[model samples]
Target: MPRQRKRACQDTPEPETEAPAGKLVKANKAEIPAEPLGEAKTSDSPEKNRATKESGNETSRYWLMKSEPESRLEKGIDVKFGIEDLKAQPRQTACWDGVRNYQARNFLRTMKLGEKAFFYHSNCKEPGIAGLVKIVKEAYPDHTQFEKDSPHYDPSSKKDNPKWSMENLILS
Candidate 1:
């Protein structure tokens, strides 16, 4: 079997519970098909694993992104850009942004266009895999990190070469 990459994220913070309403949406998938249940076959055979590993031209990639239902500031408001929030969007589309951590920011840089990411809810009563979102847009500088009024703003981050990046993840 192939070895998985050791990411910087240690605590997933996902609690087992009900799923989110964000699943009932759609997105473009000309190459890969959507699975509403978020279930897929995991090959254990050496031959099958070797075959997948040999497919160097494969463009699709999978990911799991964790988000909190309510942020520290929005705790009492019962509002944070969770799965529900993404579903509430005009077209059920949103971007995974405002990542202040350096390590997480680096992970975002690795995201490629059309990559599939599982939207997992964290810091909530029912924290678990909620739905799926596709990386419609690739990594780019996060504009919020430049705004002085925004909590994600970084004074040290230069405009030419920003310290953070973000990607558009729409419901799939």
Candidate 2:
């Protein structure tokens, strides 16, 4: 199993469907219907659209991954994937997985292969863009959500219908 992560908010409305395997999805919607669970689903446009995957050569995209320096920096108690730790990984790569937020999970699901993101260190003594990381692997079910002992564990999540996903990142 993979690392655990916090599950999505129960109030957040679910996506219409999961993105297909080996495909790309663009979150073109102005906003997604997520607030409280009781509210009715709303859309800015009359027509409905689905997340589409790219079939051919696609352009690379950019992203910014923020983290608190103390959480991931070397010798930190939390020891989540930090800048220096990623450098020591085999091939200087590590799994960019274990995110618990629903919205963040959606972004990872729709991400394209080879996309590059700026690793920004947040809430630290010196907070700024630390380095770069490339998406080496596509999103897949994060198995950690089910681990009872893990901080990210979610008993409500199931294997067949995983509530979380993850990807592998290589330092660039």
Candidate 3:
């Protein structure tokens, strides 16, 4: 069993739970492929470990993003979103939103297009890296922060000067 943890959606906290043993489920009741359940494989080679893309003089960096696999409610909104949910999006693309931490938001702002990230399944029974996603778009204003019903919403955030940011990712 994996230890439970609190996920931060801005100031809201959602309890994480273990994912049930079965297929990955989408919001539309469709079944999507899930990562194999077991220990995650790793490589020690610097070449393989460093998944970077060179652009001009800058190199894209790697990142690990954690999401809950099971359903969890926060502020009347279900904050349960994971790799499977992402894979179900149109063209396998979705906004990496709901992050409110200032530091984490800053990190999101720094992400470059074409960068790859490990989609880690957090707060689940078999928590581990589920798959990889590519940064298809750079940081932008997170629309979830503007929705009053969203768990990530912030009443104080202004449209002219958004306090939160998000990135667009596609399954890789």
**Best-performing candidate as measured by lDDT:** 3
Indicate whether candidate 1 or candidate 2 has the larger TM-score: 1
Q: Residue-wise lDDT of candidate 2 within 74-137, one digit each (tens)?
A: 2222535457655655455556555789888888887656676767665556655667777677
Two-way TM-score contest, 2 vs 3, winner: 3
Local distance difference test values of all predictions, in order: 0.60, 0.56, 0.65
What is the lDDT, from 0 to 100, of the residue 147 in candidate 2?
66
Poorest 10 consecutive residues by lDDT, candidate 2? 32-41
Pairs in clash, predicted candidate 1: 15-127
* Candidate 3 per-residue lDDT over residues 52-164, each given as its tens digit: 33433445566767688897777655677787676655556667788988877877887777776767787777676677777777888888888886777899999999999
Cα lDDT for residue 61, model 1?
Answer: 57
List runs of model 3 lying over 4 Å from the truth: 1-56
Give the winner by TM-score: 1 or 3.
3
Task: Please give me the total number of clashing residue pairs in predicted model 2.
Answer: 2
For every candidate in turn, the CA RMSD to the true structure comes to 13.2, 12.6, 11.6
| Decreasing TM-score order of the candidates | 3, 1, 2
Of the two candidates 1 and 3, the one with more favorable lDDT, higher being better, is 3
Q: What's the distance in Å from true for residue 67, model 1?
A: 1.0
